[model samples]
Target: MALPTFTQRYEAGDAWLANSCAHPTLVQDVWAADMLAPIPSGEEWLVAEARLATGYPKLVRIRAEQRGPVLADPVMDALWWLVPLGAAEELADVRQLVVQAAGWCLNCPPTGWQVEGRMWITRPDGSGLLTDPAVLAAAFGPGGYRLATEASR
Candidate 1:
């Protein structure tokens, strides 16, 4: 069987995000992206947010596969990462990290589509893969932005 095309993969990811979050409808082959969608905390995923200053650098340190779903909000000057539920407590000590727990709602862009001045820095892959809290916390340091390659050297 031939591998799935980019559009197919994108649609799969889009479906996954919708089911995981707001379950927005698709019309005219275009996702609903004019407004932000609310993503609830707890159950399946927890959102870990950080200032753009810290978030960008952290991504550099974590492995691509481990980074998971991340949302970049230029207007808010923030980056949001989706991790497994309970990440909030594990990453609590990380100064720049704000791991949102149950009851919070995050305005997010639809997977593979930018909306409301927000875009996915690392869109969800439809595999239910979430960033590990320990890896995220390890990324936080006084050392500043260090590339993944530099970390090993």
Candidate 2:
């Protein structure tokens, strides 16, 4: 299926941002990569962003389940927002939103990725911090932003 327009996707709300606290450093790094150029014809690009405990962004591309044409390498599959080509202007706005959402998520405490139905914060050495119910509650309780589920989409 063709991806939704940038405005539609943005208006649909950020499921990843609503569910997890992305690391600020990582967000900055993704923004810094300046990968928002025009996508070549017949070439599809996937951009994924995550928040890490470490104050640095790691841009390693990994294998991901096929969604579109398999690009050279896939980035993180969880807690990631995909930006397609021809959305340069929207891309800038989305980056800012992601950064802001990461800030909000960070404020909630114990920031991390929500994967496999669990919330996990990562440590510098690639270890996951034990899940804290309190943190989870604060981040995803009543009045919290509800991430858009696939069914809803």
Candidate 3:
């Protein structure tokens, strides 16, 4: 099934945020596109995707930093996928999916794209950090991923 689309407001803001957060070396290499761009020959890229508060999806791409040639660059190891918040049949299912995604991201070698302290769920209304596995499980558990105080902090 096709993943749900988030609202346009969320998309715009996310694009802006992604560009603003880009590493200094990648200032000219950043792009905000609906779909990921093809990696150029001899160039490495990192891709990350997530949904905004308005339920809009956003994708960020960054030029991967390379060292020596064979060494893996942790900052360049990227992943992109979507978990439809509206598609979950139960709270437990949502929690499970999130945990699994976070775990997968977190377990990658240190030379992999770091998600532990950087991943998050953003909305035009609010946002939540997804660094802690326990926090994710608790927030997405019985409460259904929306807590009143989680906005913009």
Which has the greatest TM-score?
Answer: 1
**Per-residue lDDT of model 1, residues 7-71, tens digit only:** 78677777777676544453212345367767576767888889987689778778787778888
Candidate 2 lDDT over 1-153, as tens digits, reads 996664454323222322222343443343245322122221222332334321112112211221211111122333432334333333343322131221112211111222223222221111211222222222233332223352265
What CA RMSD would candidate 1 show?
3.0
For each candidate in the order shown, give its overall lDDT on alpha carbons: 0.76, 0.26, 0.26
Q: What does the lDDT come to for candidate 1?
A: 0.76
Ten-residue stretch with the least lDDT total in model 1: 22-31
> For model 3, how does the per-residue alpha-carbon lDDT over 47-77 read when each residue is reduced to its tens digit?
2222332112111111111111111122434
Q: What local lDDT score does residue 28 receive in model 2, on the 0 to 100 scale?
A: 34
Q: In candidate 1, residue 91 scores what lDDT?
A: 87
**For every candidate structure, what is the RMSD over all alpha carbons to the true structure, in angstroms?**
3.0, 17.7, 16.3
TM-scores of all candidate predictions against the true structure: 0.84, 0.20, 0.23
lDDT computed for candidate 2: 0.26
Q: Top model by lDDT, which number?
A: 1
Which pairs of residues collide in candidate 1? none
